[model samples]
Target: MLVALALLGVVCLALGGFSVRLLLEQRRQAALIAQQATQGAALELRLKELGKRLESYQRINVRMGEELGELRKQVANLPERLARLEQRDPASLSFSQAARLAGMGASAADLTQACGLSQAEADLVARLHRGRPQD
Candidate 1:
């Protein structure tokens, strides 16, 4: 009977040790799982932030493309207007008439002052005024 009790006590001690070891292992595994979950949440937040920034950049790109198209249309119309203005005759008028037809304003004095022209130069401009004359 004494030997049997001693054997039973040894078996109980072995089981208690095994249970403690298993409990520690379970706790370690749980801690590792929690850490992984935290990391995953952080990664998800970062991904969302990146997605928002990408959307903003895409919107800006689209707006810029629209503006560029408008600029291209305006550029395309320029040559036609220039061609019409270029076809007018310059030498057929008196100096004052020539200046008026050339889109120089009604005030010849003001035009001369603004252009820093001598009287002779102003008279020459009136005499040989051309449409869209070069600076």
Candidate 2:
């Protein structure tokens, strides 16, 4: 009976040591899990912030695209507008024709109205080329 009791005591001591070692290992694993969880949470928050920034950039890109399209339309019509301006230019009139009209008794007002000359230009032509009567 005494030997059997000693063997049981030795077995209990062995089990107690194994339990303590197991508890220590569980504590280490739990600490590692907690650290990993904290990192995961931080990463999730960073991902959300990055997503918002990406959305803001996308909105800006869309607005820039719209402005680029408007600029393209203006550029497309530029040649036509320039051609119309060239057609309306009054500088195409020659000075000799204005002088000849003034010598034919045309008034300064007539020169301006009929020959595309400016008022000052018509007046100068009239002064230089007014008809002279034969003596």
Candidate 1 lDDT (Cα, 0 to 1): 0.65
- Colliding pairs, model 1: 95-126, 95-127
For every candidate, C-alpha RMSD to the true structure in Å: 10.1, 16.6
- Residues 1-135 of candidate 2: C-alpha lDDT, one tens digit per residue: 999999999999999999999999999999999999999999999999999999999999999999999989966765464345335653886556666787889899998888887887677667666884322
Clashing pairs in 2: none
User: Against the correct fold, how does model 1 do in TM-score?
Assistant: 0.55
Give the per-residue lDDT digits (tens) of candidate 1, residues 19-120: 999999999999999999999999999999999999999999999999999988976765454344335433432334435544543344544565544565
* Highest-TM-score candidate: 2
Error of 1 at 39 (Å): 0.9
Which residues of candidate 2, in runs, are more than 4 Å off?
83-135
What lDDT does the true structure give each of the candidates? 0.65, 0.79
Worst 10 residues of 2 by lDDT: 81-90
Candidate 1 off by > 4 Å: 79-135
